[model samples]
Target: MGGVNCLRSLVVLAIVCLMTLFVAQRHKGLTFYKIDAPVLIAHGGGGLPEATTSNSLEALQRSKAVGFCLIEVDFDLSNDEVQLDRKMKDGSPILRDDLSNLTPMTLADLVAWMAKNPTIRIVTDTKDSNEKLIARLSQTGLKEQLIVQVYQADQYQIARNAGFDTIILTLYQSTMSDDEILEFAKANRPFAVTIPRKRATNGNLPERLHEEGVQVLINTINDVWEGKAFLKRGISGFYSDTLMPKGTSSC
Candidate 1:
């Protein structure tokens, strides 16, 4: 019985790897599974309940126990990229993604945490504008698990060239027109296009996304209705905060 079960598991694993590799050919070398289910992907370093732990093992374990294999997390860069989002004292963009200088954990800290939790997959956000740290992260052994999300097309291309893809390029708030969005997909085939749940109003985005050969994933939805609505809207996937555990009401 054990042998049979092991064989079955191996077959499934092989299939998953093949599918991942197939999708990854365009987005550098990282393969992503297009999970169509309404995903309760938690953010913060750790999973929920211990999300405040900031990438601690307890938070990861909680996410695991909650049956969340997919989630979002941040990787603080070593060097700060001074932009203009939240300017510093001098009115500069806060280059403070990782808090190695201000906060406790550094880049090394996040890498160490990733090593401890191998089962969890993450859509890694740069938080600021540091491609160097992202480049370094692409070289990790667990590189396949990381989805490099960049808003800038130039940065996206840079990361794509680095052999660490699984990417989701953030669309500017309500700026992507359907034709533009379709064009974007044609240019970046197979990689996911991340859209806000509220902005996924065009009933044709899903069809066009499929026709354009790009995956569709919505983000940051917290309400149960939103989750269900996105699923019904034909979104390829979505992120959530509730972190639904197994046997819990999907409601």
Candidate 2:
């Protein structure tokens, strides 16, 4: 009787240890590029309340000051395709969101600022060719700190060819079936996939992606509750135009 009880206890202990190890392995596998789950990416540098413009250096600074380490910035080529310019000031490239603004932050200005502040990571939303954008970022020596969001497979290939460590596929179109999406994800092995807030909230895509060890991030989530809800649904992160308050833990 006593021997039988001891054997049962040993068996239970072994099962518990195995379960713990499996959970740890699963958690480690879910991390993207060493960044843990529940990332908060500030969209366009988070210029809400009408104070600053999106993609402006002021907005980026504000987001950083509010404890957001990840910021998404838009990169667009000039009309002539000569260079990547968000806005222009006297025919020179600038970072201001408003085209009519004279006091615009140039790419050089942003690079200098980033040099001073090295903790911030950038998410590049390129409106030009991936090769061009990657070349531009590489010039600043910040390519390693970037998570490039690509809309097409060719763009993804270009970024991969450029040796980008982190790439995100922005799937805004519903033209592709779920199987197609999964197959593409398997083939490309992107760090994460960005989808619409509605789809992320209502579907099992997030779970399916998690099973495949891919992270799901929702875009343009302005409401704090909505962002929390998505996180509860096992979303890896969200892009938001308004920064969450200081000390908001993703865990």
Candidate 3:
């Protein structure tokens, strides 16, 4: 009789374990990138050595040769119009770009370029991405490759409402506490968080983010050691612009 009772208890334990696994998977929403190590995401248009990048054919060739799988670029709306307005550190504005020029790009033009480059994925910053522009992008061939990112929570809601399943955004610098960040990350369950390396708060913060189903990607890492440090702290990836590190390789 005791043996039969033990077998029944074992069956109950197994059922509980499977249920726990199901809940864990539902909560974690973290999709493994299948990409290991830190990914080198090209900043700007990967263009000229000067201030503003080319965003031209040259940028595409350069990034591909360097083995960069991700390209991060700016996409803004005019606020008054659906036309794009982007700003680069070089002081060039996308609005100022000539319609026939190759130096800069507009959002509509950006989508056209993405369709041309099917090999690389893009993380587009929607600083001013508006309803009309987003609707247009949703109809583009490159919509699947774009990650709609915004710093504002309202924008997050907008993207979600627009049927964007993946979002790359950051915690507010001023008001977000670690506890709150963790709760929000898990609750909303974005694909990833793109934040400056300096703003990660601490090692624990990233782990918490991960626990909440958000992968932390530290941005603008040119130094190799800093990249390694983030890796040690459990960050999923980083935004880098240099060549491969002397030692380690892919994740």
Q: Give me the candidate number with maximum lDDT.
A: 2
Q: Which stretches of candidate 2 lie over 4 Å from their true place?
A: 1-37, 51-53, 80-85, 93-103, 173-175, 245-251
lDDT of 1 by residue, 148-189 (tens): 776655666777788876777666433657787777668877
User: Local error of candidate 1 at 122, Å?
Assistant: 2.3
Off by over 4 Å in 1: 1-40, 46-57, 78-104, 172-176, 202-204, 211-213, 245-251
lDDT of each: 0.58, 0.70, 0.60
TM-score, structure 1 vs. true = 0.63
> How many pairs of residues in model 1 come into backbone collision?
2
Clashing pairs in 2: none
The true-structure Cα RMSD of candidate 3 reads 19.9
